[model samples]
Target: IGGGSTHAWCQVYLPGAGWVEFDPTNGIIGNRDLIRVAVARDPNQAIPLSGTYAGSPDDDLGMKVQVNVICEAVAGDSMGASAS
Candidate 1:
């Protein structure tokens, strides 16, 4: 984890591919343009915020998030399965 007043999240793993990044922080997933600092032994260790503040604490923090998943038809991908 790094130092800041921020938030972030990760993605589930695929069979062939390794862990891809999914930002619950910014509602973005597998965005190659975004930067990934580091990963950890466990997901809990990868928070974007973890530090102390020296100044007087008087400010408030609030955040909002949204995610959208769309599925479209693709060639060569089977939909139905045959049962014996």
Candidate 2:
């Protein structure tokens, strides 16, 4: 895994490669840290986060969310080396 800011990206299916990921926001190809959270033919179908809260207007304090990705070295593998 790698560390980067949260951004939206999409994937395309290639003939021999199958599904490949692309990050238009960062101009990245074959993203290393991107995780597939949802799959949909339309962008509106795949939502990163959504929810509803029921409470008094005055009681609502809003919400705070943070996401972090941590990468761990596999057994017998060098931390600085890339996996094939």
Candidate 3:
């Protein structure tokens, strides 16, 4: 697993490929263009030391994100996963 302030993702080693990344956070699959910094057993280990620093003793914070999935059919391919 790996993570950064901008993105976090995990990878599995394949026979032919060193590591295939899968972004559980955003559900994105393999790609070399993806920004990656480190890898570990889990995401927390990839964060920089400063990432855990709090602004102040009394500071509080919350975060929220939204994701959407859009699918479409190609000229010669089936649209859904089960299609053949």
Candidate 4:
């Protein structure tokens, strides 16, 4: 979403706090604005876009996808703040 493409985030498990989410693209430290579509150890395991096309090579004009993200405020949640 930062550079007009699909954004990626990560999650790390802590000793006592459990698993924490981090969005490097937007500097977000929580899941307030993120959706857990898939979990994988390697980035390739989670392909954002994939499909098979059937038609003439010249007839293919390519494909385009548009994503919109809507975030809502959570009361008493300070972890949503951007991490430094």
Best by lDDT: 4
lDDT of each: 0.58, 0.69, 0.63, 0.74
Give me the displacement of residue 68 in model 3, in angstroms.
31
lDDT score of residue 58 within candidate 4: 72
A best-first ranking of the candidates according to their lDDT comes to: 4, 2, 3, 1
Candidate 2: 10-residue stretch with minimal lDDT: 1-10
| TM-score of each predicted structure versus truth | 0.37, 0.43, 0.37, 0.50
Q: Candidate 1: misplaced stretches above 4 Å?
A: 1-7, 14-19, 43-50, 56-84
Best by TM-score: 4
lDDT of 2 at 25: 74
Give the lowest summed-lDDT range of ten residues in model 3.
Answer: 62-71
Q: Per-residue lDDT for 12-83 in model 3, tens only?
A: 798988878877766677965466556678767776443466588677564443435455778888556583
Error of 4 at 69 (Å): 14
Global CA lDDT of candidate 2, please?
A: 0.69
Residue 31, candidate 4: Cα error in Å is 0.7
Better structure of 1 and 4 per lDDT: 4
TM-score of candidate 1 versus the correct structure, residues matched by position: 0.37
Model 3, residue 80: displacement in angstroms?
Answer: 45
Task: After the best TM-score superposition of candidate 3, give how far the Cα of residue 21 lies from its true spot, in angstroms.
Answer: 0.8
